[model samples]
Target: MSLPMLRASRALSGADMHAESHAGAYADSCSSAGRVVARGAFARFATTLALTGALFASLVASPAVDAKTAQPKPVLDASAVATPDRYAADAAQQMFAAGGNAVDAAVAIAFTLAVTYPDAGNIGGGGFMTVYMDGKPYFLDYREKAPQSATRDMYLDDKGNVIKGMSLVGHRAVAVPGTVDGMWEAQKRFGKLKWKQVLAPAIKYATDGFPVEPWLQKRREFAAQNFGGKTNFDAYFSNLKAGVVFRQPELAQTLTRIASDGGREFYEGQTADLIARQMYGHGLLTKSDLVQYKAVWRQPVTASWNGYQIVTAPPPSSGGIGLIQLLKMKADLKPQFDGVELNSEPYIHLVSQIEDRVFADRQQYMGDPDSYRVPVDKLIDDAYLAKRVEDITPDEVPGAVPVKPGLGDSMPEKAQTTHFSVVDKWGNAVSNTYTLNGPFGSGVVVDGGGFVLNDEMDDFEIKAGVANQFGVTSGDVNTIAPGRRPLSSMAPTILTKDGKVSLVIGTPGGSRIFTSIFQVMTNLYDFNMPPADALAAMRFHHQLLPQKTIYFEPYHPIDGELAEQLKTRGYTLQGQTFNGDVQMIRIDGTTPQPAADPRGVGVGRVIQ
Candidate 1:
């Protein structure tokens, strides 16, 4: 079938898409005070009074009834949460109802996803968190670390060639996880509820079981086919089917231990031993590595664009820096995009040109700051960005601007990462994105730990210039080394206006994460679209390596005219499914407006 024909058949109008996306949402808005008023009845009475001049004048002269005196207002004005699953969203609401804040809700949601959305929400994986509290921005780096026995060429053949799939599958692919530690650290620092209080819901779900959704059931079938006898995957996940309740008693026990004894139980206690045993002869991780694992609190990367502040994850994630560059470059070259309509042929071309350059810089200069001395300041400098786009023009494609790192000498980061955005009534917000590198991680479930371990080893550059599973490449700055963190594309971002959080947003799409975020930001801030329309809008991605290729979501294919124009400009147009699963919340006044990506079966709820 032709591309245009397919688009016409499948593409939904903005209003239809928004309605369909939120059809499964738990609630549009809920008031906790339990008081209900009939606005329609009040309006009818007011209309009747208007018909009688004397009565209307008398009513207008009297003071209006004080709502507070008539009925007590709810303790919380408003709060919101958006996640990739309905179960996780419900868990977050549970924490909020218990007097917990955004941090507590986030911790609860993450643990709940470990049981319900195992594809990416995992306790055995690692990721970054960007927090905004009390007008200050903070970043947490709990990304998985390479084990002590890791080497520069651990995934290479003796003949010096790359060993395909070695870094992607099996026990050898596992890395020391950091999610449990990360959650613990976040709660200890900012959470209001007790640790056990936040974990109660996840334990209940795992012990009693929840019905499997279609997405999760498909993942189970895939795991059975690909990892049937490779590990203990089948023993744990093979029996799950759509519409059936799936329980994990072993995982419940593990969560129970961690809740009772604290995060230490997962590191220095019995859970650590189970992980060590799982990797006994097939992997390099050990009990010692687990004992030494610590999630670090890092300074968030912050930059100002127009009037808003962009606070996002810093290196080892190339996202924060890369996002800053994309915005600044677009701002610098504003004249080129002045008259171009958004998503129009000219606008996409200009954006793609800027994206290609930023990604080229990402490949050469991004990595774990702890391992490499990344030249962050030099890379995102205003002068440097201006020079990078000096040659860009609107009418024609510029000859190859050398695809090299912008700085003469620089330092330095996929999909399956799940993101959830939360906001409490107090205005505190948390944007978190974590992953296991791929679905079900390395497909190796620990004997007693009962969770999948991350194959984050594949995130490192197995060989400089060679693409990993996500088609993203990196330089020597990201080579494997003991205790070193791998470069990541997980960009958990928060935008603040006038020192107050205005938006909380992030997504999971491996290499497409940051770019997807970039587009959503433009859709909201630049085009002034509603939150639902912004999230439901079609998206595009352009990484540097694939020459002149640009990928768009297959379900929301590009317009025929736009596609033809892009092709005419020496660009290759590719349609790929599932561009991103973006979970976002925009704070309008004191109310939080939440929107979940229509592409995924997620939920967004507003609590009043």
Candidate 2:
């Protein structure tokens, strides 16, 4: 086993290490009447000295065994967390400071985001989390499930024709949420903090009110535009105003109940009752559905690329498997990026072809593992990935080549999700991505729960060979069934080198999540870029079934002469808005370097 090498990017200050001592220098040296207040002076001096002594003591306590230089940057010597919201990151940092491991911090971040980032971060939604505890990896699948009444053609009309937006919008769209149970389960099994303590920050944020960011307001307006006249729309948006304090009293109360009773309250108690009542005449979820819902534990999908072992969510989430497959293919092709210029024509074209090839397999082979036989072993096989790479061309674009799903001589995976990464002082690491499916998720809030319901039912393949919103088409493997989890693109991944988690990366974009995480991984490992540069780098996405074009972000420097170069080669290029808000934490040497996606308004915090 080897340790990570550190890079000098920023410096840490003495005051940043200890604030009380700096302030104590100006404290009252003597009290009024001048009784020679030696006791008070000595107490304050002693306190300051102790605080400073501990600061240095902690540094000396750890050997910095991984440090290459005589002295390493202090900034890289601390625990850190990164999330899509400042409040949520703060919650995670607080947990870490309170002697919590990555799992505990993750639970805190999960609940805090539900309150602060309502558009995607949610308790009403569900997702997959990959946890690395003591160097061993585990996966928790809390993906939202189809209701018991769900059927293969539930979203189809009489003639077996798929309903366009039927599964995306109303009460029927809501699934039995598993996020609450998922968080509780992870915390109970691997967390170091009490369940209630982990949820306290979120409860306080919801009840005491949090300032509405511009992004949240924009999302609110977007929801209103699409679902203005829908039932309960006003209830969730009545007090939503930009740049003002937005309080979720109902959500706060619900959180309070969950805190006191553990996650059981959400699954079978008051919150579930409210959800049932809200869907009584409109949705398919019954009290029984809620009570029966449970988050299952799955072994994490594993693969290797560039000396790094990868652990990620499996099966129901095609993201991880897809990423591993893509990386393997890239490694086989070994396309040199000419000084790592990712925007170069050969690099972009080769990578896009790889994406198209994998996605073609994804549309046909992936589904919930418990519901069907998924050829996970065969899909990630080196020979299979090498064969998939052969379909790609180094110079010309591989325009929509029909790549068949590999058989292990067996078989093969789609989000409006939120993702966060946490690495505590301990070696424990967590990468999680959860969501409500769409912007406001079904555009309905429970009557008294003050939470959005996930329309995850739409994630299923409504009909064979038809692409959903994320553009991945599926067969019966992903067809709706009672208690079955739909295919998803929520890829929460951890990369370990020599048995130590080196990088935790994930993102939120329906289909883009897979490509986004893949890009960042390549950027860091293959290209050897820093975490921030890796995330800030311009990205492109390709889905095989739809368009067969590589969608480039607007920020990509491929206009004018460079853009025209690709046009002559039959490369279908489409310039579009940015895709995927990725969150990453890189454990370098003795420090944790966290970086939030620059494309989003999220924040990263290094625990001091």
Candidate 3:
């Protein structure tokens, strides 16, 4: 057990305020004007200082790293990233500028993110992607699956009851990996760059070294508790706990091998051998399973929302179904509005109703299309959508009413994953979402792999109402079966108008991501708000699981009777969780305006 060296990148302005007098210098100095006499002078000084502070905070929190050093010039060009860190973005951007299409760039960047930011995402995670080309769109479904040896009752307890499956630690909690194979397959088909070139950045970051972003550091600190005190994990976290930078040399070397050999190197080469050995020695992964693992690249689902055609990942990616389904429901209501109106009851009511129906469908029949017989077309059909919308009136009921959602029948929950979106100069766009299912992804980093493996297979319903590791339960629709892709909410979405891309967008908020982006797009096109304002607008989420409507305060940003109009709709509201990270680019004619969500350290780069 050894601590890999780390590189923590940061620029500190001294330290936390210790002495009040000096605190005034860094703090109140920013706005700490007291009754320093002339009293009136204080007000003016305070205002100026406050403004200065705001400017400083703006830059510090800005997604675009200040031109501080010779780090690397960004060439992402209207590229927005929501990966765990900047290194991921850099690796991705560098690839894009080097002639790699979004496919090449994204795969490069994603591997870097997995290695550098392993707490929330990594190679251990599996992902979903949506690609658009010519006049059509395609959904790339390379979601992770259970090992062939995995059983319907593998997650069951002593009483033959299904316990929360893969949310915890150890090999038995693992799901067969699909990320490497998925990335390789996508890049080979759509990327302009060669597999070796596309993989170079991630390989280098892993093999050589890169600085750890503050966010990565913080996540480690929190995750340290969960890792317990295993010698290897202890060595890993002790460095992170003390603010020491950590890197993944072993993982990098493994990635380098994969880059040269492709997914085969990971699943069937030395890496797969290593993973299988660990699984067999520690719990259950079989060599046959590793050898059989391969990535899937399929067509994405398309939907029309208010005249604009949208594209997203399909089944195996419930995100596509859920995203389009909810929009279809919303469009059915025919709610009309001009300009921004956040948290207004009518707006909230309409969105909530649509969300409720969409989620109900998700619960019923959204899973891997191969194993499950999902009437995806029926689920997302306008006729069925209109029927569901007709079920809702101007009332706020408990949402428990049995809404008969069409689409054949139910499927189990798809494995969870993460998302990323990219648009380069060729007018080509890629919207992607990848995940390890949850933070730390079963909390098991593949030994010498420097990445966590996804427990996505646990997303299936081993039993009706059986809770997963995250304390979330699965329904009949999300139950598992052989060769089935589980349901998911990681939506890599986009909107095009006039045959030009209007918005390259997506987010990562479990079931809530659908509504969050839905609101953002509605705000931009339907309401005509500026990019920043549209992003800042208050939002709401309806998952239909707990059945209570959730609304962020900012969703109702405008004041006056609009607020009153909302309350009359019988809305059950709460404070905004505000965790969704949405990145988008709006094409205003021939130009592009890029905006990244302020929820974290996201940067949107324009080619100009």
TM-score: which candidate is best?
1
Q: How far is candidate 3 from the true structure (C-alpha RMSD, Å)?
A: 13.2
Best by lDDT: 1
Window of ten residues with lowest summed lDDT in model 2: 21-30
> Candidate 3 clash total?
39
TM-score of 1: 0.86
Q: Residue by residue across 180-262, what tens digits does model 1's lDDT show? A: 99989998999866676677667556544678777777876775576647766766676567887765545655665666567
Superposition error at 500 for model 2 (Å): 1.0
Residues 1-608 of candidate 2 have per-residue lDDT tens digits of: 00011011101111112211100000000011111322343234334434455453343223222345342223236678888888877777666665566787788888888877887878888999999887699999999999999888888898889886778888999888888889889978987666656776676565446777777777778876766566566555645667677755556556656765668777777668878998998988898999999999998999877888999989898899899988888888775434546767667777777887788778777898887777788889998788767656665446635556655324332216888898866667899999888887887777656778888998998887788876678777888888899999889999998888799889998888988898888888878898889988888887875554667787554668767767766666776665888999888876888899889988888887
Question: Higher TM-score: candidate 1 or 3?
Answer: 1
Model 3 misplaced regions, further than 4 Å: 1-84, 134-136, 164-167, 227-232, 241-243, 335-340, 404-417, 467-474, 549-578
Runs of candidate 1 with Cα error greater than 4 angstroms are 1-76, 226-228, 396-399, 409-415
Per-residue lDDT of candidate 3, residues 326-353 (tens digit): 7777667664423325556656666767
Task: Give Cα-based local distance difference scores for all models.
Answer: 0.77, 0.73, 0.58
- The positional error of residue 211 in candidate 2, measured at the CA in angstroms, is 1.1
Better of 2 and 3 by TM-score: 2
1 or 3, which is superior by lDDT?
A: 1
